[model samples]
Target chain A: MTAAPHPGRTRRTVVLAALLALLAVAMLAGVGLGAVPVGPADIVRAIGRALAGEARVPGDAVIVDIRLPRVVLAALVGACLASAGVLYQALFRNPLADPYILGMSAGAGLGAVIALTLTASATALRFGVVPAGAFLGAVLTIVFVVRLASLRGALDVTSLLLAGVAISYVLSAMTSFVMVFFRESMTSVVFWMMGGLTAASWPYVWMVTPMLLAGIAVPLLSTRELNLMLLGEDRAAELGVDVERFKRVILAAGAVLVAAAVAVSGLIGFVGLMTPHMVRLALGPDHRVLLPASALGGAVVMVLADLVARTVLAPVEIPVGIVTALVGGPFFVWLLVRRNGHR
Target chain B: MSVRLAYEAATVGYPGVEVVSSARLRVAAGEVVGLIGPNGAGKSTLLRAVTGSARISDGEVTLSGRSLAGLTPRERARRVGVVPQQVSATFSFTAREFVLMGRHPHLGRLQQLSAADTSLAEEVMARTDTLRLAEEPVDTLSGGDLQRLALAQALAQEPEVLLLDEATSHLDLNHRMQVLDLVRELADAGMAVLAVFHDLDLAARYSDRLAVVAGGALGEAAPPPAVLTAGMLSEVFRVRAVVGADPVTGAVSVTPVLREEAVPAAGLGSVLVIGGSGTAAALMRRLHLAGYAVSAGALNRGDVDQAVAAALGLEHVALPAFGEVDPRAEAAVARMAATADAVVVADVPFGRANLGNLRALAEVAPRVVFADGFRGERDFSGGEAARLAEGLAAAGALSVPGDIDSVLAALERFTAR
Candidate 1:
């Protein structure tokens, strides 16, 4: 059968285009507004030369080497987290669900702290060891929580959330124990826990791109199922959805997205939780539209947050996570108050 | 007249506990069958079995001779559509979007809804009269509106068999009838419909057949007139009710007997009431409420007093309607009055038909209390009834006003003795 024109198709397209434009502007500002500022023309030339594989200019290293990878990495991590947020919110059928709600951040933090304490050399810590450890820990924690929550092959959302909370507390306490004993690694562990994109590189951007694409693509393909899931699992099942298998697929996808983002960016907060919620408030909750809009909205928020993180403190950089929370916290509250007032 | 849906000895429940056992039923291609029961009698479980939500451990539920256990959820949904009791949506979806989700089972994994599907959704929405709320968010709609939208969504599935699990409980009376009318129209178009209803009257009105679930077993499915009876109402529902045909709709009507308190076992002894043509209905109810074993005599069959007596589960002597009190009925009334602690003669106007009731009261005059209010004009036997009443007064029969409270007070004095 031929595909019908959706009623919200035009509005979704317009919202997506506007978000894409906003993301382009945010990336431009991120690249041009650092301590050693570059002009728009210079930024364009730097990107062009980098794409053409030409010889480097005097200002090319600053734009191409430093700001470009960081901005791109910020955008990827933001999209990954936001898409995860959308999947999770639909999976649990709760608007409050987010990327880190299943204890992924705490698990990653614990793993990163363990790696920092074990490795005597800071160079090894900076290489792939810490991120690999974080990824492994996050996935393991999610699997354990899922196993704990499932009974007779049915995954109970309430039990899953409770297990996540319990496991998060235990892992966080272990991380604190490691930090207290290994005094030399304390500052590094603290910095990682606060989260930053200071370790951004071309390799890191290359690593996250495919996974981020998969994260976004999976939710986009399953938008119909996700919309059905919002009514509830039982209702979704009655509508011919294989609810248990669907939950597993979504939970696995969300776990991978969050774990990948956490491995690269440490424990960034609020981007996942706030971005999807903002998009849903502006655009309605048709996952066909909400998923794509949230991906773009999330990328815009993170790129801007990273821009503030590097520039607001000048030479001494604040963690990007702190910037997001400081900005996202107030904006989220304002949205809630405005929505309540309308109601 | 093929059976589209059938439950052949189905026993449904979750893992060890059986909620419903040995349920056998069938619905033809163009019939509406209603399932009724008290709370937790497994009415919903039977519906769930059809949707494959509950497992049938014993026999099987079949759709058009094929077992439902083997069909995939999409296949089952394509054939059987269910409108559940309620749905709590966590997200804000427009009414149109919500209705479009019903086309999910028909669409393939990657297939978008075609133009045909969209028009079908619109058609169902119009049929359910919810097209005006298409753009409104479902969460913002009232309960009745949401229920109609749910029906629209279910209809959009285009299933051959429709199951409603108390779907109309949230609707107002007008909307309830509107929805049921739409359902009837659908059944007339040859869809098999099964609905669970807590409202007995509605079930009786709309159902061509009804299946009763009680005490974990399924009763026989029969026509509404056969299923809804005073005996069944008292036995299964534990309430006294009068089951009759509605004068307006020609459907079986059930009027529940509302008891203020449980009638004690003749705490004030038995009271025999003599009256006809509704004069003794209130007095019978008041006496029954006061913990007396109340009996009425020589009440014409189909009289208001006879219905009240039957509804109250009181022993009474009934005669043919509009006929003179026969000798057999008068003897029965005399036997009841002889055993009663006191007899009450209600302010019934004397006529040729019920002059026998006054004569029956005269045999036990010493134990009788008359609520006659000294009205000699009510004697239509031309002073023959007035002369008998004066003779009863002379024999020490107590006289009280026609009001119920004064008659009750006079009976209280007799009980004090």
Candidate 2:
């Protein structure tokens, strides 16, 4: 059944529409602020010629081939991370939970590093090997964490986070122990963990978009069950929710989402933790609105962060993760100190 | 009417520990059954067993004669609704939104609540007096309001059987009566209601029958008068109490005479009182509350003294009000007089019709206290009452000032025997 509007949906509609508009402007600014400073008219003509299947204009190769792919890839990764955040938060029933709070990012990073160090080259079939290992490692770690955190049909929130942190420390130690043998791969691993969108290309965009769609779709379809779960698990069961199966499906979807984002961009922090929270504070915690709002907010924040990452230092190229942390950390602290609880 | 819910020879437990063993009870439509026991007496466990939260290791628990184990949760929910003892939640949903969840079992898996389902929720909320609280967050409401909301949600199920476990534990007097009245109204509407109550008096007042859980077993289910006997109350609850009839509703009532509050301190023994008007009513209550085995008699039935006796649960021997004094009633009074350790004759002036009461006092021997004026009014009907009074005084009956305090002193002096 369709949801009737709840408490000021008009304002939320205005907020969402503004986020999309801001994202459009940020994308244009990102494309326009390069070494050549491609103008709006240049972007329009380049796009017109490219879509018309005609010969490229002068700046067509720069805008259509280079910047657009990078922006699209950043949007996809951002949407995936934030959408996964909502799923994990609901699954654990903890507002502090995030996509990688349960060590999915650390496991994914370890998987990518192991693949990189073992291979003779980190390029050919590199994407396939690393993403598959990362996805497998992330999913397996989630399963183990879930088992450790559950007691007699209920999940314990404190134990789930503790298990995740414990596993993360051990996995990071294992990665380091292996890294001592391969110094060249170790440098690439560190570079990857810093996280950036500079490797943006059409292939990377193709790699993350489908997963982004999947991550958003899973929560969209299960919003009702998610609402049922907001009351404790037993109450949900008494009301006829198959809680175990619901948990498994949502957990797996969240693992895939974090695994996909981390595989390509390596451990981008704060977007998954902060985007959903910001959206939840602005709109209420109705997952129907909150999930999509988080996705859109994630996309906007990631694109703007990327815009700053590529341009602010002028060709030096800061990692997008650093830019996100620089913005998100202060805002997060402000939220915690300024507000007592949800109004 | 057919039984809507039944537990037959059921043994419910967790792991190796049995909580409710060999329980046999049935609740039929249009009945409210109260389950009561002392703390740790498995009252909640028996309730949980019925709800399927605990395992029924043996025998049968049925809903409408069909085994509960065979039905799906949603199917069972459609028939039985539980008003849980407490609900704690993190999401701040409004009361209306929370109450709407009761319709979940009736809705299709993917279908949302229809207009009809919503209107039904509104109706139940209004019935529970929670309509004004519809917009308030559930967590922000007071305990009583939350309880009302819980009732609304349970009623929204339109269930045939309702289970309540200590549902009134957190309520005050007004809300407690309101909740019991609601349960009665629901039962009257062809629903079976089983409630767990810690307040035995409240249970006795509202329940058609009571099932006592004690020593890990369920006692027989019987009407309040039979189940609330003083012997059973002391054995099951370890409290010294008197079982009486409610003056207004004629329901069973319990007056606990706490051991620390009474006879042990005063050293009073069993005292029987002869009272007709309202004169000895207060004295009878004071002696009974002081933990004496107190009984009053010789008052006409349906008179002030009899009504007071019924209210205080002070057992009394009564004659038909304003009728010829019957030999059978006199015989009953004489029989009760045989067991009295002491008897106090009230300051009532004797008439020909009531001459049997003073005559009955002849049977109480060791000590009898006559009020002061019995000698002055002893000349009625050629001094016949006067003759009975002098015989009592000759039998070592002490005369008091005929006031409340002096009569109590006279009774205390008799108790010293």
Best by DockQ: 1
Indicate the worst ten consecutive residues by lDDT in candidate 1 chain B.
B257-266
How close to the true structure is residue B266 of candidate 2, measured as C-alpha lDDT?
Answer: 49
Candidate 2 segments whose C-alpha is farther than 4 A from its true place: A1-26, A29-53, A115-129, A139-167, A327-343, B2-18, B22-25, B40-42, B45-73, B259-417
lDDT of 2 by residue, B261-367 (tens): 34344436877788776667667767776657878866777566665666556677666778645677677677777787778887766778777777887866447
Measured with C-alpha atoms, the lDDT of residue B271 in candidate 2 is 76
Off by over 4 Å in 1: A1-5, A111-167, A178-186, A329-343, B258-261, B277-282, B346-350, B366-407
lDDT of 1 by residue, A1-343 (tens): 2234565677778889999999999999999998888888889998999999999989899899889999999999999889888988888776656656577777877876776667757664544666666766777787787788785478776687678778888988998898999887788667877889998889889778877776567778889999999987777878888777888778767766776688788888778889999888888888988998898888988999999899987998999999987876686567657756966
User: Which numbered prediction scores highest in TM-score against the true structure?
Assistant: 1
Candidate 1 has which clashing residue pairs, if any?
A: none
Count clashing residue pairs in model 1: 0
Score candidate 1 by DockQ: 0.51
After the best TM-score superposition of candidate 2, give how far the Cα of residue B261 lies from its true spot, in angstroms.
13
**Stretch of 10 with least lDDT, candidate 1 chain A:** A1-10
lDDT tens readout by residue for model 1, B179-238: 999999999999999999999999999999998999999999899999998888888888
Prediction 2 TM-score vs. true: 0.76
Model 2: pairs clashing at backbone N, Cα or C within 3 Å: none
